[model samples]
Target chain A: MSEVILELDAVVKKFDDNEVLKGISLQLHRHEVVCLIGASGSGKSTLLRCVNLLETIDQGTITLFGQSLNDPRIDPDQVRRHTGMVFQSFNLFPHLSVLENVLVGPVRALKRKRSDVVDEAMHLLERIGLSDRAKEFPERLSGGQQQRVAIARSLAMKPALLLLDEVTSALDPSLVGEVLDLLRDLATSGTTMLIATHEMNFARDVAHQVAYLDGGVLVEQGAPDQLFTNPQHDSTRLFLERVR
Target chain B: MSNITDESVSEERPSFFVPRRKQLLVGRRGIVASTLSVVIFLGGLVAVFYLAPGGAAVRRFYFDRHDMWEAFVGNHNAGLSSVGIGIFTNIWVFLVSEVFILIFGLTIAWTRMSKSPVLLPFRILATIYSDIFRGIPVLLVFFLVGFGLPPLGIAVVSYQSVAVYGCVALTLTYSAYVAEVFRAGIYSVPHGQLLAARSLGLTNATTMRRVILPQAVRTVIPPLLNDFISLQKDTALLSLLGVIEAVNAGTIYQDTKFNSSGLVVASLLFLAMTVPLTRFTDGLIARDRKRRLASS
Candidate 1:
């Protein structure tokens, strides 16, 4: 088996009186694409947000690439740089252009020369088929195009693990195809991704491991064919039926 | 039983009233109020015109005006030698004063970021400086430096030296105000931006220098321009200290001519320098607001 790139051990997150993550634990191999699926408020997206430290966990531990994400010794900022997140809102800097947004991390975070980062950012933009829109502001682009830019931004960081927090959940139906296609391309390239999404068919097609979740608990997990065709949990069966 | 397209089932006792988009145009009363106000204002304008001294006053006002314009004209008031002297001697001092204010204000504002007990007094001092200077008018500051501070080891100088004192007084009075402006602007930047920059492994200084201050300053360009225009007008108050800036020279002409036209000339001269800046700041504010709206 490939080495584990990430592991969450009995991670628990609570907000006020409500518990969002109830002692969740999981492990993923390097270059694995794990799809997390469930109904609304299932803690799937919150789990992904937790991986990048956007949402803090109240207790337990998370390790990414042998680095303890929950360790006091770990710098959360440094951990954030190695593990990239693509937000549902696509939080591109409004003042920056598309190309500048991609270069923001490399130039500002990595402290690379502007001349150097430009070519790399340009190449990354071309990879996402947005070279022409590089000079354009995000407001000028369609929702799919902005999401593509957000992906390019994540890819620019060259992260070891990618955490996607319902990236296409905000898209219109017509724009979902392009974003999914790009994600499929990323998955095929063996980039490790933990995608928390509501799009069942896309998850089935692109995911290597599909897990069903219910109310902050991982209910069932298996290969896509096994889980969808033969769910062992009654909750999973009922949930799938509702979504269908 | 259907994907929300079952019109036949929907026909069974359901109200499907699509909301018409509401029009938010002002009513007839608002329009009447606006028209009535405009007429009243125009009537006031006509009343002023009737009350104002007629052709003689305007003829007096319009002539010998635009001295800053006439200063560059045929060598009449001062020599070409002195005009170059005026531009270089006085204008460079003005530029220096502006630069000095910008630097000192930035320093004063950033000093509040220090976490020292010694800086506690400085913070209180800076706050008091801003409040006292900003609370009191600019002219009073000039008067203090010109009249009040003179006997206390600070002899007031004349000509260019007087301008320097005026600039210094401007700096003292307005630095505190500008510092407060900078402080308010820096605080206006969202804390998330600083956190994001910090997350990039940037040091506190580098994050502030690279990300926070630049963005914050862009948002505050309008207010900064307002301060600049006010400073330029306050340059006139320097006449109390005997500095022969544009307005001061106009005052000199008024004294010689025994006419109020020089005051009008001075006001127009002040307007000439300030109107473009006012428009430019307005444009900057509008553009920033539009960009923010679009982004949100």
Candidate 2:
């Protein structure tokens, strides 16, 4: 087996009186793609947020590359350096040009030289087919284009793990294909990714592992084929039926 | 159905359809509205100048051309400076105070927004500073800084020039208001931007500086300009401290010449500065709205 890149041992999270994640455990190995499938408010987003350290977990440990992320001694920022997150809304800095948005992480956070990062940043933009729109701000781009730039911005950091939170949920139906196509390409290239998505077919196609979550509990998880064809839990089967 | 086909054939002539009539910059309705506005404005002026009781006396006292020009040029015999020149003092105080207000306001806002345990005490102090300053009337702050500070016998606080006192007073009072504006701007930026920045491994301070503040400052530009317009006007309040600003110069002329035209000139000077700024701010707000509408 490949090296374990992320390990979640009975993770728990709560907001005030309501628990969002209930002792959920999962694992992802190097160069693996895991798609988290759940209904809204099933704690999928909260789980991703916990792994990114945006929200602190209430119980259990999340080990990233064998480092205990919940340890008090670990700087969250330092841990975040190895992981990149693309948000649902594609929250690109409105004031920055598209190229500058891509360059910001490497040049500003990583302290990489601007000249060194600019070429790579442009190449990333080129790969996203946004090199012509590099000088324009995010507001000028279409929703799909903005989300693609957002992905490119994260890729600029060259993170060990990428966390995508419903990245296509905000795009128009006509625009969803473009973003999903890009994700398909990324999956083919073997970039380690943990994506929380509603696209069941995409999950079935691209993900090596599909974890079905229902009401903050990991109902069942296995290879996509097994999980989709033969869900062990009644709740997982019900969810799949409802979604289909 | 036949007419529809005819319309489609016409549409195929060219993608662009030029209207038969030239588009008028001002329509007939616009012309009528403008004419009505002009009439009402002229009527109001006529009533003020001719119909009101004491119109002649008021005009002689307030709008005497000779006294206005004399006040503007200054009366050397009276040892008083020109109101025009005195306005420069107000401008200088405004410029210096604005620089300090912006710097101090941003610092206070940064201190308030910080989440680190290390900044707790400083954050509390910042909160207290903004609360106390914002609660007090600006004029009271002016009095306290202008008169109270110099008596403290501290070397840095004991400035002899009333203009220096004015600058300090304006900076202290306006910084609190401006700090709140900055805070509002920061909060107006979506939380996702912060998350996105932090996820890139940027520290809190770097995220704020690089990602948050740039966006925040853009959103707050109109409000900031509004505060500045108020600040510019409030510089006239410094005249009470014997700073010889435009209003003080006008009053000096009023006392010696016994005509209020000098005060009129002072008001006109203020209006000249503020009116353009007000319009510019409105233009910015309109442009911002248009841009947002287009993008959304």
- Give the candidate number with the greatest TM-score: 2
- Output the worst ten-in-a-row residue range by lDDT, candidate 2 chain B: B17-26
lDDT of 1 by residue, B50-113 (tens): 5776855665554544533443232344431112223333444556678889988888888876
lDDT of 1: 0.75
Model 2 chain A lDDT-worst window of ten: A131-140
Instruction: Provide the TM-score for each candidate, comma-separated.
Output: 0.70, 0.91
lDDT tens digits, residue span A1-244, model 2: 7999999999999999798999999999998999999999999999998999999999999999888997889999888888989999999988788999999999989999999999999999989898998888788899999999999999999989999999999999999999999999998998999999999999999999999988999989999999999999999999899999
User: iRMSD per model?
Assistant: 4.7, 3.3
- Looking at model 2, the pairs that clash are none
Task: Write candidate 2's Cα lDDT for B1-296 as tens digits.
Answer: 34465544555445464453633325685677778889999999988888688988998999999999999889888786699998999888999999999999999999998888999999999999999999999899889988898888898769568889999889999999999999999999999999999999999889999999988987899899989999999999998888888999999999988998999999999888889888987887788656644533
Give the top-scoring candidate (lDDT): 2
TM-score, chain B, each candidate:
0.66, 0.83
DockQ scores of all models, one per candidate: 0.15, 0.57
Error of 2 at A70 (Å): 1.5
Model 2: per-residue Cα lDDT at residue B82: 90
lDDT of 2: 0.91
- Residue A67 lDDT, candidate 2, scale 0-100: 87
